[model samples]
Target: MNVRREGTAAKAAAPTKTSGPPASLREAGAALAGLSAVFLFEMLDNSILNVALPTIGRELSASATVLQWVTGVYAVVFGGLMLALGALADRVGRRKVMLVGLVLLGAASLATAFVTTAEQLIAVRAAMGVAAAMTTPGSLALAFRLFDEDGLRVRATTLISTVGLAGLAIGPTAGGLVLAFAPWQVLLLVNVPVAALAFIGIRRGIPADQASGPHRAPTDRAGALLGTAAIVLALLAPTLFVDAGAASPLPWLAAATAVVAAVLFVARERTARHPLLDLALLARPLVSSGLAFKAAASLATAGLGYLVTLQLQLDWGWTPAHAALGMLPQVVVLIAGGALIGPLITRVGLDGAARLGAAAVVCGLAVYGLLGRFGYGWVALALALVAAGMRVVGVVAGTNVMRGLPADRTTVGAALVDTVGEVTTGIGIAVSGTVLAKLLTGDIATATWSTQQTARFHEAVTRAGLTLTVLAAALVGWGISRARRPGAARTASSPGH
Candidate 1:
C-alpha cells in the first residue's frame, strides 16, 4: 500500500471504530440531560448529608465521633475505590457501572431511612459511600467517551457543573425543609427519587462501548489493592489523627503503611505485564502537573468552604439557613465562571488559564485570611467581601485544572483530582477544627475576666478561619509552581458553543 494511502485508510477506519454518541444535536442534548441527572445524584448526596447528621445523631443516639464518621466514611470509601473502579469503568463499561452505581446509591439511601441503631446507620452510610465511589468515576469516564470533541466536552461539563451548583444550593435547604415536615427517614429517602431518575436516564441515554476483558492482558489486581489502600488510609488519616495524633501508634503506623504501599505500587507497576494503574503515564509532565494543579485548587476550595461556614455560624451567629444562603454568591459565580472559562481557555491555552485562575485563588484567600483575622459580625455584612473572593478562587482553579488534561485519562484523572481534593478538605477541616476546639477549651479554662473571655472567643474563631485560609493559600501557590509542566496548557473548557 502507498504510505499516504495507508495513512488515509487508517484514518477512515478510526471514525467507524471510535465515534462517540450520535453527532446530531438532539442526541447530544438527550445525553447531557442524562448526565445532569447523574450530577444531581452526586451533588445531592454530597450536600444534603450535613443536615441529616443532626437528625441522625438524635434518632440513633450517636456520639459526636460516630456522627463524624457518617460524613467521613463516604469520603474514605469513595477515595479508596477511585483507581480500581476507574479502570473498571474503562475496561468493563462506563455506562453499565454508572447506572449500577445510581441504583445502588438510591437503594442504599432508601434503606438508610429505617436504621434503628447507630451501627445500622453506620453500615448503611458505608454502603452509600461505596455507591458514590462507583458512581463518580463511571459517569466521568462516560463523559469522555461520549463526547470526544473538545468543544462538546466543555459544553457537557459546564452543564454538569450547573447541575452541581443547583444541587449544592438546594440540598441543604431541602434537607431542612424535609426534616421540618417529616422524620429523619425523609432525609435519606429523598435520594431515592433523584438517583432513580438518573439511573433511568443513564440506562436509556448512554450507548455501550466495546469492553476490555479477558482478551486483554490480566487485570492489575495488586496495583489496585495498593493504590486503594494508599488513598483510603490517607483520607482516614485526619480522623484517625483526631484520636491518635502524631504520638499515637495507629496514625503513624497507617502513614508508614501507605508510604510503603506507594513504593510497592510504583515498583510493581513498573514491571507488571498488566499493571493495575499505568504509573508510567503519570510520570508524564502532562499527567503529574495537571494532577497537582487540580489537587491544589480543590484543597483551596474545600478549605474556603469549611472556613466560611464556621465563620458564619460560630463567629457571626447566622442561622443554619442563613449559613447555607451565604454560599449563594460563590455558587452563582462558580457556575457562571465554569461555563465561560472553557471557551476562553480554548482560545487562551491551559497554562494561561491556570495562572490566571491560581492568581484569583491567591486574591480570594488573602481577603478571606484578612476577614478571618479581624473582628466578626452579622452574617450578611461579614460575607460581603469574603464570599465573592472564595467563589472566584473556586471557579478559576476548578476550570483550569480540568481543562489541562486529555480525554482518554479523564476517569483516573477525575478520581485522582477528587481524591486529592477530599483528602485535603478532610485534613484541613480536621486540623482547623482541632485548633479551634482546643483554643476554646484552653481559653475557657484560663479566663481572667468576663470581658476578656468574650474577646478571646472571637479571637480563637478568627484564628481558626485564618488557619484554613493560610492552608488554602499554600495549596494555590503550589498549583502555580508546578503548572508549566506538560499538559497543563490544553485548556479544554466545558459548557460552550
Candidate 2:
C-alpha cells in the first residue's frame, strides 16, 4: 500500500500557479466559507426532509414506500455518480465542476418547490442528488489549492468536517422552525438561495482548475455506469420489499440485479485502463477500515435521525418544531465531541480513538435498547453518546484513509470517502425505515390503534434501533481492529500523525 505523498497526483492534475500572492489565512477562510455553505446545505437538506417527511406525506397522500424513496434516492444517486464525477473533476477542474454542480443544484431545488406530487418530488430529489455528487468531492478537494501548508490544510479539513456535523445537528431545528410559519415546500426552496450564495462565493474565491499535462489517463465510463446501476438497484430493493408481500418476487429480482451489477463493476475495475475506482485500495487496512468505519458512523447517525424524527412526530404527537428542539442535547454533544477529537487523538493513538468511538456507539445503542422504554429523554441521552461516537469516527477515519492512499489517487480516494458516507447513510435510513414500517404495520392497519398499541409501537421501534446500532457497532469495531494490525501502514503527512 502506497502512503500518500505530497504534491503527487493532485499537484499534477490541478496545479496551482505559485507566482501570485501566496495563499493567506484570509483566502483559506473564504474558501472554507464557500465550501461549508455547500456542504451545510446538502446535509441540511437531508435532515430537514427527514423532519418534514410526515407532513409531506399527509399533504401529498404519499404511501410509506414513496416517502422512503424521497430520502433514499438522493443518497443512491449521489453515491453512484460521485466517483466518475470526481475523476472528471480531477481531469478537468474541481472548481469548474463544482460551479456547474451549484448551478444545477440551485435550479433543481427551485424546481422542486413546484412539484405537486410525490413522484415529482422524488424525481427532483434525485436531480438534487446528482448535483450534490458533483459538488461534494470538489468541495473537499479544492482545499488542497487554498492551503499550501499541510498544517493549514489539516486545520481547514477539520473545520469543514465540523461544519458538516453542525449541519446535521441543526437540520431538524432549522426545518422545524421553518415549518412553524410556512408550508413544507419551503424546505426544498430554501436550497435555491443557499446554492446561489455558494455559487457566487465559489466562483469568486476558488481558483480555476489548470490542465494536467497530456499524460493523464482516460476516465472509466464502463465502471462508473455499472457501479451506478448496482447502487440504484441495491437501494431500490429494500424500499420496495418493505411494502411488498414476504413472498413477492420483485424484491428478489431487484436484489439479484444489484448483485450482478456489482459483480460486473468489480470485474470492469480490475481490467480498466483508468478504473472508476481502484479495488487495490481495499487491500490496505487503513483505507479499507476508514471506509467501513465511516459507513458505520453514518449508520449510527443517519439511522438514528430517521427513527427519532418519526418517534417524536408520528408516535408521540409532538409538533415538528418540538421534535426538532427535543434533539438539542445530541447536537450539543456533537459540537463538544468535534472540539475534543484532536485532544483525544493526542492522548490516544488513532486506533485507540476509534475503539473508544466504537465502544461509545455500542453503549449508546445499549442504552436505547434497554432504557428507551422509559422515555425520549433517555433516547436523547443515547443520541448524545452516538453523536460523540460519530465525531470520533468522522475525524479519525478520513485522515487514516487518506494517509493510506497514494498521493496520485487522492481525487478518487476523497470521492470514495464522501461516497461511502452518503451510501451508508442511505442504507441506514432504508434499514431503519424498513424496521419501523414492519413494527408498526399491524398497528397502522387497525382502523384505530389503542394508546397501548402506540406505546408498544414505540418500544418496538427502540428495540429495532438497538438491533441496528449493535450491528453497526460491530462493523466499526472490526474496522478499528483491522487498522490496528502491525502491518497497517501509516502516512507521515496524515493530520493526527
Candidate 3:
C-alpha cells in the first residue's frame, strides 16, 4: 500500500472556505438545526436507556450481568470506533458520512425497538453504536467547516453542546413521559423520526467538507482495528467487575487483552504512515488538558445521574414520572449555563472558567454528600449545582480543544473528546453501581430493601459524592497551573488562557 507523506496531506487538507454565501444566521440556523438533531439523538439514546433498564429487565428476564452488558456494550463499541470513524469522515466527506450514519441510525433504532430478546436488543444497540461512531465526529467536523470565523465557530460549538447536553438532561423526563403511554420499546423507537430529520438536514443544509488534492493516505485499517479493540476491551472489563464477582476470570482476561491491544496500538501508530489517531496531537498541552477535564466531568456526572435515577425511583419509591420531573431543575440550569458560556469565557478567560466550574462542582458535591441523606429535595439542588458547573466547564473545554486543533484535523479532535467522554462515563457507572450492588446484597433492580441495606446504600452514595469532589478539586489545581504557565496568555482568540 502506498503512503502519502504527512506534510503533503496536511497541506492538501488545509482549511478552505466552503462554497456558499458567507456565514450568516440563515446558514448557521440550518446547520445548527441538523447538528442538534444528530447530537440530541445520540444523547437521548444513552440517557433514555437508563430509565428503561428496569422495565426491560423485567420483560426479558435479564440477569444483573446481562443488563449491564445491554447498557455498557453501546459505549464500548461507540467510543472504541469513534477515532477511526472520525478519520474516515475527514477522508470521505463529513456531510456525506454523516448523512449515511443518520440513515443507518434510524434503521438500527427500528430494529432495536422490535427485538424480542435481551440478547437481540444488545446486538442491535451495538449496531447503533457503530452508527453513532460514524456520526458523532462528523457532526462536529461539519460545524467547524460551516463556520470559518473563530467567533462563529465558538458560537456554533456552544449551541451544539447546549443541544447535546439538553438531550442528556431531558432524556429521563422524555422517557418517563413515553413510558406513561407506551411500552419500554418506545424509548428505542423515538430515535427514528429525529434521525430522519437529521438526514434531510445533512443532505440539504450542511455543505460538503472533504480533504482536497491528491496526497491523501488510504484509511488506516490496522490502527483502527487495534484502537477499537483496545477501547472495547478496556471499557468492557470494568462492567464485568461491576456486575460479575471481582473473583471472576473474565474481567481479568479482558483487562489483559486490553493492555496488550493498547500497547500494540501505540506501537502501530508510531510506525504507521497513516495512523488512525495522530499520536503527536495527543501530546499537545491544550488537547491533553482539555481531555483530562472533559473526562473528569463525564466521570462525575454520568454516574451521579444514573444513581440519582435509581435513588428516586427505587429507594425513595417515587414513580418514574415523578423522578423525571425531579430532574427538571438541572436541565433548566444547564440551558442557562450554556447560554452564558460565551460571556463567561470572555469575563474570566478559558482556564479561569474551567477552574470556576471545577470549584463549583467540588463545593456542590461536598455539600450534597453531607446532606443528601436528608431528602430527594436536597439531592435535586445538588444536581442543579453540578449540572450548571458541568455545562460551564464542558463548553470551555470543548472550545479549547477545538481551537488548539489544526483545521485539517477537526474530526480527530472531535473523536478524542468523545472517546474520553464515553470511557469515563462507563467508569463512573461501573464504580458507583458496583459499590451500590455490594452494599445492597442484591442486583441493581432490587425492588425491596431492609433498613440496614438502605443505610449502607446511603453510605455508598455519600462515598461516591466525596470521591467526585476530590477529583474535581484536583482538576481545578491542574487548571490553575496551566493558567499560570509563562506565555499561556498569548492569544485572545485561542480558547485556552
Candidate 2 — which residues are off by over 4 angstroms?
A: 1-27, 49-72, 110-123, 144-151, 172-186, 213-215, 245-247, 309-322, 349-351, 375-377, 433-441, 445-463, 490-497
lDDT of 2 by residue, 255-325 (tens): 89989999999999999978877898776788888887888887777777777777777667778679868
Candidate 3 lDDT, 1-497, residue by residue in tens: 12558777877899976666446646667667888888888878878888888899999999877887787778888888898888887677677778888888889889965788999999988989888999988787677667656557667777887788778877877887888889998888888998987887777777565347111678889998998898888788777777575668987799899999999999999999888778886655566667767777777677778778888887788897788788787778887777787787778877777777766666777777778778877887888878877887777776667766666667778888888888777777777776676666655467788887788878988887677667766766675565455534343245422
Please say which candidate is ahead in TM-score: 2 or 3: 3
Worst 10 residues of 1 by lDDT: 488-497
lDDT of 1 by residue, 253-325 (tens): 7867878888888898898887766666565444455555555455556656666676666556678778777
**Superior candidate under TM-score, 1 versus 2:** 2
Work out the TM-score per prediction. Answer: 0.81, 0.81, 0.84
Clashing pairs in 3: none
Candidate 2 CA-lDDT value: 0.76
Q: lDDT scores for all predictions? A: 0.64, 0.76, 0.77
Residue 184 lDDT (model 3):
91
Please give the distance, in angstroms, between residue 164's alpha carbon in candidate 3 and its true position after superposition.
3.2
